[model samples]
Target: MSVKGIQPIVSEYHLLWEALQHYQERLEKFSSMSTDEDQQLKYDEKLQDMDGLLRSIKLAAKNDYQLDLK
Candidate 1:
């Protein structure tokens, strides 16, 4: 593909990386906080959201283009 065609994919990858980093930071912060049931649930949901994001990325890589996530 031409450079122009690849630009959007690169931009999307960067955005996804940023979002994953934000979620990682939040999960780390949550780890040090109180383990109340509600908080735990929220933390679990956040983890699921992260997993969903990852799955989407993998799916895109499989169906759309080759992505070296590792």
Candidate 2:
């Protein structure tokens, strides 16, 4: 594939990374919630989303593209 085609994927990877980071912060807040059941559910969902994003990042990296989350 052309470098041009890879550009959009790279952009998407960056967006997903940003979203994962945000979800992580939300997860921390959820952990501190007094409501156990509801907060735990939200935290679990966020964790799953973060895992999915990480997996996507790994797959993109395997394609020899730089995600560069930093």
Candidate 3:
């Protein structure tokens, strides 16, 4: 299937992408290290936040701009 025309190069898109990358790297680092009970809870929360952020970014790209970023 063919792709659409030009997609808007918006700052929000780039910012979201960068933020995702940042979170992903942090998550990887956290995964590699050991955590105590309290730290584990915080890490889990952060992972959830990252998941939500990713979903929001994907939804925003599709709904707000009609761009299927995936």
Candidate 4:
């Protein structure tokens, strides 16, 4: 019931936030399972991808819709 069909995209924004949180939780689990420093570093690198994606999403929201995330 959005005026211009924007509701779905708005929902997508929130879902992306949830996805980011879920990814962080998974990263924490991976860290806990890593017993050595080198093992932890490997998992740490995995966050770079997620962080990059989040930054991109935030930028898109602001630039495309002038929406302030969070």
Worst 10 residues of 3 by lDDT: 1-10
Pick the winner on lDDT between candidates 3 and 4. Answer: 4
Which prediction has the highest TM-score against the true structure? 4
Q: Tens-digit lDDT track for model 3 on 11-57?
A: 66767667786887787678558467677667778888877877767
Q: Which stretches of candidate 1 lie over 4 Å from their true place?
A: 1-8
RMSD in Å for candidate 1, one decimal?
5.5
**lDDT by residue for model 4 (1-70), tens:** 2344444375687687678869877987897798998988877887777777677777766766666666
TM-score of each: 0.60, 0.53, 0.64, 0.67
Give RMSD to native, each candidate: 5.5, 4.6, 7.3, 5.8
- Computed on alpha carbons, the lDDT of every model, listed in order, comes to 0.65, 0.67, 0.66, 0.72
Model 3 pairs in collision: none
Worst lDDT run of 10 residues, candidate 1, spans: 1-10
- Tell me, by lDDT, which candidate is best: 4
Which portions of model 3 miss their true places by more than 4 Å?
Answer: 1-9
Candidate 1 accuracy as lDDT = 0.65
Clash list (residue pairs), candidate 1: none
* Model 1: per-residue Cα lDDT over 1-70, one tens digit each: 2233443375676577677868867886885584797887788788778877777665564445566554
